[model samples]
Target: MCYVMSYIRMAMCVILFLTLFTGMCVADSKGNLALNGMAVQSSLGHPQGDAQNAVDGNRDSDYKKESCTFTKTEFNPWWRVDLGNVYTVSNVTITNRGDCCKERLRGAQIRIGNKLDNNGNNNELAATILTAPNGTQTFSFESVNGRYVNIFLPGNDEILTLCEVEVFAEKKLLINI
Candidate 1:
């Protein structure tokens, strides 16, 4: 009788452990959410510097390659991407213009949120570019839930240029055990 009781308790314990573990396990997949997102900027510096180029999955830094975005020289020039749905953003990777003026991206602010106020530039500040990048830089941070990401440069005669902007996030699937 003692042996049978011990075996039954062990079996119950194993079953309980498996059920709790299964419930806690979340299937998550991380991907670039900005790849197919809609992008826009304050103003165009050139016809070839369309905002869509930043999300074209190309990191070509050379403007001549026609894979970068340029904003006309203005105060607080900003660029933004509309992520189709709200996500817990993990990080933001930015490729600077390598052909010529890489310093144009310095002092830029990255904001993320669902609010459309100020063209979404007034959202939560995620990161700031402290110095000019030679090629590319990735800014990782605590997860922020938002549907829009904006890059804003605050100053007069400032030009915002981005070769590529990649937003990474993980989508989690909850499983009920």
Candidate 2:
């Protein structure tokens, strides 16, 4: 009986370990190609309102209460994300602040390419948002292949507040070892 009980306990421990570590083992199993929670940056950012907030998987627009980036009002403020590798981007979804000032996202240009010149301004233009609505907005365009995705707001004095930015592309399957 003692040997049987010990075997049962060992089996239980293995099960628990697998339950906790399975998520880590297959973390990239998402069927879609959206590079969520990846390396991101911006020209201007605050301590609390860091650039990663836009990709932190949170859509809460209130920067004070939630995770979001606030750039100093300046000419051509921009935010960008490196997709790690070049991908055939299908579309990009941006979430605007629902609390206030959703109009600040207007006239923003979404550019995608491998070029880093002039803060990715030289990249091919994917889409230009004329009037961005509140909440999440998905901008679809022809598949553009690039390693970097940039969102630029051109103006003399304007702020760019992005709650969330989701980039979707053609999904790539990974083989788990």
Candidate 3:
């Protein structure tokens, strides 16, 4: 009887562990939250380079393809996305222009938070683009809670362009006791 009880207890423990593990995996697989979000920029560089292009689920680096966003040369040009609701963002993936002038994104700041002050540019500084890349780059850091993600280029006569901006996050799970 004792042996049967111990075996049953061990089996129950394993089952519980598997259940929790599966939940966590499901939460993390929610995919890119920014795909359904809304995007905006400080100024439009061209009609084809609208802010909405960044979240249109296309990562084409060529600005001519109209899949990237562009801002006119100005001080502190910024692009932002509203994620609809607050979420614990895990990482952000940014695709830079590949056709030319990929260096325009250098020194860009990635800020995340719920505050709309300064058009969400005053949010928590999550990361910075230290180097320009011709392809996609993913920036991961400690999870940040926010409904807005802003990419601010702080400098004089700076132009901000983004081929794609993908935001990935784990959904908050509520467990009932």
Q: Which candidate would rank higher by TM-score, 2 or 3?
A: 3
Measured on C-alpha atoms, candidate 3 has an lDDT of 0.87
Each candidate's clash count: 0, 0, 0
C-alpha TM-scores of all predictions: 0.80, 0.74, 0.81
**Model 3, range 102-123, lDDT digits (tens) per residue?**
9999999999998989989999
Which regions of candidate 1 are displaced past 4 Å? 1-29, 173-177
Error of 3 at 138 (Å): 0.3
Report the alpha-carbon TM-score of model 2 versus the true structure. Answer: 0.74
The worst-scoring run of ten residues by lDDT in candidate 2 lies at 23-32
- Per-residue CA lDDT of candidate 1, range 9-81, in tens? 9999887887687543344646788996899999999999999999999999999999999988999999999
User: How well is each residue in 1-177 modelled by candidate 2, as lDDT tens digits?
Assistant: 999999999998886776576522212323224335454444555677677778777778787866677788788888888776666787898988888888889999999988999888779999998997789889999988777888888888888888888888756422222
- lDDT of all the models against the reference? 0.88, 0.76, 0.87
Question: Which scores better on lDDT, 1 or 2?
Answer: 1
Superposed model 2: Cα runs more than 4 Å off:
1-42, 172-177
Sort the predicted structures by TM-score, highest score first: 3, 1, 2
Residue 109 error for model 2, in Å?
0.4
Collision pairs in model 1: none
